[model samples]
Target: MPVLRPLPTQGAGRLADRYGRVATDLRLSLTDRCNLRCTYCMPAEGLDWMPSAQLLSDEEVVRLVRVGVERLGITTVRLTGGEPLLRRNLEGLVAALAGLEPRPVLALTTNGIGLAGRAEGLAAAGLDRINISLDTLEDDTFARLTRRRRLADVLAGVRAARSAGLNPVKINTVLMRGVNDHEAVSLLEWAMAEGVQLRFIEQMPLDAQHAWQRQTMVAAAEIWARLDARHPLVEDPADALARGSAPAELFRVAGTTHTVGIIAAVSKPFCGSCDRVRLTADGQIRTCLFSRSETDLRSALRSGVEDAELAGIWIAAITGKQAGHGIDDPSFLQPDRPMSAIGG
Candidate 1:
């Protein structure tokens, strides 16, 4: 166990880092367990998940989020998971987070397996928006991409989210080189028709197998070329600028109000304006998605530290946030934990 760093007695404002970026968006992982074994994320057999005892209980999660929102300056809270729907009491958890004194804009990133049954309840429980992962539209391709044949379930979940008024039902699609790369335009067409936002994310180096290669990963330029050839996308500079710290670069679907986004994490590198921080399911603070070090808070929380002290620790952690994810550096090393363990 690493020793806890000394807390700063002052600076009780936002979660600002050394690079002058203030983090207001918090991505908290409810569980490090997922139903699918996506080829880009983890092995088909899945990973050795964290023990239930090591996982944060519902009460602990609520307390930490409350400290973040009330004490720190977290305005947006996105609940993530190996698959958040696996967390049995997710609706109740959403309700608790929603009931905070200064309620956050609660959102969820899910695989959408069992979401059809619970979308309405989640919406009622104060979930503001949702981002579902749908890499391919073809069932066979989806099965090959994500070692499961539940593409229909994901589609159902997307529709359910829309029906339940989860506005801006964003779809997060990771385009691999030869696999599912051809579906980029088709996916966008589906998203536009479904009245949802679509974002094509550049595949990063977070896969469990460590098999990712720059040559093999689909580039942002290639994605744009494919889409532009079909729909003629125009840069929505105003909308992109308005998003502020959002990673996605917004573009208008030429001559239409509908828009599409591309998160060129590897190609464009948005580290200069990153405003997000991640909290692992086991109560560790990850300043960056590719951070190798994690500050343990579960121990401090269980040790009965005051909320202020916890806030101090959180601030200290962010103070050491990296300038970039460092995927391009010669010294860049993939974190030991894969996306499944680290949370999307």
Candidate 2:
């Protein structure tokens, strides 16, 4: 039997692994398929998707998550996908995770189109929170960004999530300088009124689909400046101290109690505090979002690898994680794989 020991006091920080990095968050991709062709995530003619035979079964994903939580201190698991809702029987997966002795906080990131139909089922299965990707509120712009005219569907989904008790639903907007930057204030205003947390994200070149150009990228500081001019803002006391692993710079409107966030992934890379790992839909474990290397765990699972062997695989993958992603190099070329293929 594994002996229980007292945890050390570490200045409010989480327990770090042998690598001296805290491992508390796991992002598991359920599928490499998305219904929308967002220019930022996939090409107009999307690449061929992974075969069903290769992808990890829901059971496999849950098993891996159990090991990750037990051994790597993962207390939170966020379900992502090409669009997570696209995967069927998601509630089954959610239920399995919820059955844990001390269940981790279950959350999901989605494009929000299908959320309306699934929100109730998801919450009933023990999902705690949700993050919806809404780049623009305008129907035309929304259509342009996602190549789908489903703005109304997404909005309804947000409402459904709230109705289902997914409190403080987060809205993730990628601020493209000339494209959607103009809508920043409006988006926040809507989120504030709706009681949802809005987060403006800086565009990054993680995949080739975005057709990212330097001129189109806006910095987080600029976004803050634009928003601050309209309404006085203050740093959220909860987020004042840099936790090192958090992706968003959190702040709140001066007069309002609601909070908004900004994710500066491109201009300000938060590499030092990255304490999470990603598992693609097909079971390849990626330590970094921008990593080019991945360890194949699908084959191992299919070949009947024991829990000990699987744990060893995870250990090796974590150890191989790079100190930082080299996105600053001018010679840097975007990954050939589309975000959908890699489980964005």
Candidate of highest TM-score: 1
Q: What is the TM-score of each candidate against the true structure?
A: 0.96, 0.92
Residue 330 lDDT in candidate 1: 89
Model 2 agreement with the true structure over 108-218: per-residue lDDT tens digits = 999898889899999999999899999998999989988889999999999999999998899989887667889988998999888899998888886555577766688
What shift in Å separates residue 238 of candidate 1 from its native position after superposition?
Answer: 1.8
| Tens-digit per-residue lDDT, 188-296, candidate 1 | 8998899999999999999899988888889899999999999999986678669787888888999888888998999888888888999999999999999999999
Model 1 bad stretches (over 4 Å): 1-11
Whole-model alpha-carbon lDDT for candidate 1:
0.90
lDDT against true structure, model 2: 0.81
lDDT of each: 0.90, 0.81
In model 2, which range of ten residues has the least summed lDDT? 1-10
